[model samples]
Target: MASIKAQAHHQRVRIRGYDVDIRTYGAGARNVVLVHGIGASGRYFSRLVDLLAQTCTVHTLEMPGFGSAPKPSHSLDMAGFAAVNCDALRAAGIGPAQWVGHSMGCQVVTEMALLAPDLVTSVVLLSPTINRGERNAVLQGLRLAQDCLREPPAVNWMLLTDYLRAGPRWYLRTMPKMVRHRLEQRIGGVEVPVTLIRGGRDPIVPARWLQELAAARPGAVAVELPGQPHVCMFTEPARTAALLREAASGQ
Candidate 1:
């Protein structure tokens, strides 16, 4: 997820006693749902939403304990996160949508399809986190630090603000859950269409892992945004939205 200022309709939806904040944009025929990664709120996706809102009704969610949503009594693992999100969307009368996620959000959407298959028409994973080769926390942290050097100052600042909101405690409690989830193994089994996108300069989601994820599904599409960093959706909104729009069209 990345940040930019834009106007959107905000609504609050509660599921399992958790109040989730959702931002809706556009009035197009197709619906797209954007999910943010660990320690990120929907705000990081503001820029991309502006581009996507042009041709698709886009919804951005702030899951409990992350983003603007209040912290839960306990940190939720990937499955719990998916369950709440799935029910929230269904409650909002949004379903069978193009579910797109970035980083850990990708794992959440994968679990979403598994938990509520009918709710997701397709999945687009952008810069998916916890690459198989760098599952350890230290390695992941090092990679993130390395990736930060590639990101512009603005993008890094936005990510820092979001991370601060999440706080160290909740983030640490949730980190293992993200590292442990077998997204690479689980995504291949999803019944719906799957697409994988990564920045050519992304250290988190390696080129080899992207290829492996693509190979998992017979018709899966793997795309690389050359010269883009991990948070390309923010800096390269138009191009990112184009790929997302294509996926939403069932292409």
Candidate 2:
């Protein structure tokens, strides 16, 4: 099933001045952490949340400056963001499970795996963004605009709401930090198992980048879901959840 009417228990964790909002679902043994991309909230992955809830406990995190989490005093670099987020999650007793991230969230979790190695046992990167080949604001914006033409209305609406909530100042302030990170280079530093996934139709993350990332890591798994957009987890929650379930199974 692509979705289910699962109940989410919301809670806020305050760690080292960072307020983290987490929505918990399911009571299964396997645990999965869902981290949304830049300018997005946990709601972006609601479909996947519900689907995964059926078979595993899902922790949907709203990072600082987006969603329910309060904005920070200043924009943080990838490493800084990773430290704050991982500290909060670890404080909340979450870790040693599959840490899945999308867009810039992918960079954050990968950094977390390196900084707080104990908190992340495995990492799943979905449509990781700011391709080193096209890392400028103009190019990134153009790619996003192009992808919008193919996105479903619901997906666009969700993004609209989340973007508004994040506000332009914060989003712009963090944009450069995201573009500056070298995810392809950092992925190599991650000691834990890593899985790379992307929607086949995603323009922001090209297939060549995914292949390059996989090639650099001998054991990494790369998957491409046909006919899906950047937010494939929302469009094909059941299919993505199956991939996640397989990832979590090894944990």
Candidate 3:
């Protein structure tokens, strides 16, 4: 994986009334767009992009408020985010490209597919958090309690700051909207080939959800990375890139 600073064509492009930061690498004929999860930026896909660039052109998007990008004045919801991506793709001259999204980005990609199915050739979802209602509340409670007791000072401090930025009020307001945004409903409507990626060790999004999602779609395929966690893209870049390439090639 190439470092973010080392990518030659790294630059910011204006899209959907926002300044979107994008990195383009390789000269392959097919174009692939990568989207990152919440509180993260395109840099998260640096390693995967470096590997996939060898076989296809790769474009990583830095959404508003993440990475070095500025936050928008208006609220950043899933639909708005998807529209921004659609506009960005059109502005960048990328058409009918394979959309690869991780976590929250997966929701965004699903929304985009719903809005403009023709603009997306296929989708590759990594650790998709679709059915929040089915999440293990007891496990979440245990993890919270454990983190409160054993987290290191530096890590705890960072967590505190993040919580402050993402205040209780903000979380309360945002979660309901996010929870109600149904990806499963959209999945059934997506006409393109869909591939779901799950981490074997992921606690957030269970393997069952992926299985159910794959089964809901006629030709969808699901792949699980053994011993990997929620951040499987980083932990299994080679495998993730392979899946992305397969989706891009329509194989």
Candidate 4:
């Protein structure tokens, strides 16, 4: 189990007429923003937040329809979701922070970097999802199941619980958008530094795809955690947090 930090707290703020929930931790000079994947909430980043909070101010978002954030009147597409998060960040007085995202969260942050370059210092994509080559939902599900088999039971539980909390209807509604976004095109437009972190055993995000994603962008860096599974950040918070700190510091 990961150590719990006493400093973590939740903040509710409205952005673009939608209520956004942010979990904040630590109070260091640097700012780090965490974006959770589809069917997930800020709670998914609990361990990572606790670790990073030790050295940097960290803000993890519950992207509108997920976690405790109220469900919107209508579902927002990938870009729309990213835009809302951008507004939430600005409203919270954050500017140019290191953006760290997990799974589908990577698409959200990547879209944010493209839409509002000045607001992002850098980007970290952890076990990024929806590989363009295998966008079919059935195929993705199979790969996810395969990856889950390798991940620890705790990580699988965390994922299942978060997915249930996100609700099946909303997750299904958001699936197409996540699959259709052209990450290759979008990533090409991001000028800030980008880092790709993936578990060596992540079936959803294969090593080849990670390499391809990094290659698509001029200076993007790809880091793989050998023997790790899809939810590497959740299972290896200390090591992952240190890598994030290094990426944030450009080390």
**Clashing residue pairs in candidate 3 (N, C-alpha, C atoms within 3 angstroms):** none
Model 4 residue 72 lDDT?
Answer: 81
Encode model 4's per-residue lDDT on 129-159: one tens digit a residue.
7787898888987888898899787778877
**Candidates' lDDT values, in order?**
0.87, 0.85, 0.72, 0.84
Off by over 4 Å in 3: 2-5, 135-176
Cα lDDT of model 3 overall?
0.72
Q: Any residue pairs clashing in model 4, and if so which?
A: none
lDDT of 3 by residue, 178-216 (tens): 555677767787788899998787766677888888877
Better by lDDT, candidate 4 or 3: 4
Ranking by TM-score: 1, 2, 4, 3
Q: Candidate 1 has what TM-score?
A: 0.95
Q: Give the distance in Å from residue 111's predicted Cα in candidate 3 to where it truly belongs.
A: 1.0
What lDDT does model 4 reach? 0.84
Cα lDDT tens digits, model 2, 1-251, are: 23343467788887667778988888888788888889999887888887778778889888888997999787788888888888878787886678999988998888888898777767889998767789899999999988898889988998999999999999999999999998878888888788899999999999998898887666889999998889988888888888877766564
On residues 6-102, what C-alpha lDDT tens digit does candidate 1 reach at each position?
Answer: 4577888988788789988888888899999998888778788887777788999998888888887877899999999998998899967899999
Q: How far is candidate 4 from the true structure (C-alpha RMSD, Å)?
A: 1.7
Query: Which consecutive 10 residues in model 3 have the weakest lDDT in total?
Result: 147-156
